[model samples]
Target: MEFALAALFELFESLDQCAPGSRAATLQALQACEGLAPGARIVDFGCGPGPATVALAQAGYAVTAVDRHGPFIETVRRRAAAAGVGDRVTAIVGDMRAPDFADGAFDAVWSEGAAYSVGVPAALAAWRRLLAPAGWLVLSELCWREGARSAEAAAFWQREYPDMGDVTQLEARCAAAGYAVRGGFWLPADAWAAYYGPLEAAVPAVRARHPQAEAQAALDDIGREIALWRRFGGEFGYRFVVAQRG
Candidate 1:
């Protein structure tokens, strides 16, 4: 498990993004978060490599970017500095599931394509206390799209994310977790391409470096994930949800 995790971390460490997202999509979600003026306090959970963190800081928010990985947190700090938003961004190596901030400390909580690390329901429930009254919670989660699903895709997600559900079910989860459903949108196919393109290009070099069985298994898992998206993408996608603390 340690060898596999090391291989996974090495493979993903240099990518500009750790997930399927774009600056455009991040800004779009920001726009959906009404009433937050410039310099609003925002906390980014599971902020791998700080793509969204820098974007939010660029948009004039004071952002606290949190991730468990030390290297990724350092990358966030470097990116924020390079982007000229270092003063506005605070990068920390910490668990998203149990951030150490005081209750009601933020105007918004942002996470892009990383909420699944802890189940979305648990995330929604746990993170709600960090938001100020009526503060926004924005996140993108992998979810089943409406209509037919291929057996292969179904099996893949069932094994990988057994708690996965449709958008409506997700919305219900938000409400159940004490948030008011604001709105959501589907991430485009190019979003996936953006994340996978560099990842696919980097795989061969990583495989060559880490020639152990566990490392190879990790690489194979990533390959299979990418291939599954190519074959059955329409059945599942990342849904960006904007909910306000109720």
Candidate 2:
């Protein structure tokens, strides 16, 4: 498990994005967050490499980007500096599940493609205290689309994310967790490609570097995930859900 995790981390270390997302998608979700004036306090939980963090900072939000990985946090700092938003971004290496922040510290809590690390319902419930009254929570989550799912896709997710649910289920979770569902939209296919394209391209080099059995297994898992997406993408996708604290 350690070897596989090391291989996975090394494989993702060089990528500009660690998840399926795009700048346009981030901006679209931000637009749904009404009443957030310029420089509103926002904490980006599980901010992998800080792509969304930089985007929020560029949009004039004072963002505190937190991720468990130290290197990724450093990358966030450098990226923010390069983008001229270093002063606006506070990059911290910390766990999103227990950020240890003051209550009501932020106007918004934003996470893209990372909430599933802690189940969505748990994340929604735990992060609620971090937001001021009526604050917003915007996150993108992997969800089964509302239609026939291929057997291969079903099996893959069952083995991977057995707790995964459809959009309506996610919305119900939001309401049950004390948020009002504002709106949501499915992430476009291009967003997946944006992440997987580079990931697929780098597989050979990563495989060459990690020749151990466990490392190879990790690489194989990544390949299988990409192949499944290519073949059965229509059945499942990431949904960007926008909700506000009640």
Worst 10 residues of 1 by lDDT: 117-126
Q: Candidate 1's error at 149, in angstroms?
A: 0.6
TM-score against native, each model:
0.98, 0.98
- In the range 175-226, model 1's lDDT, one tens digit per residue, is 9999998999999999899999999999999999989999999899899999
Model 2 C-alpha RMSD vs. true structure (Å) is 0.7
Q: Count the backbone clashes (under 3 Å) in each candidate.
A: 0, 0
lDDT of 2: 0.93
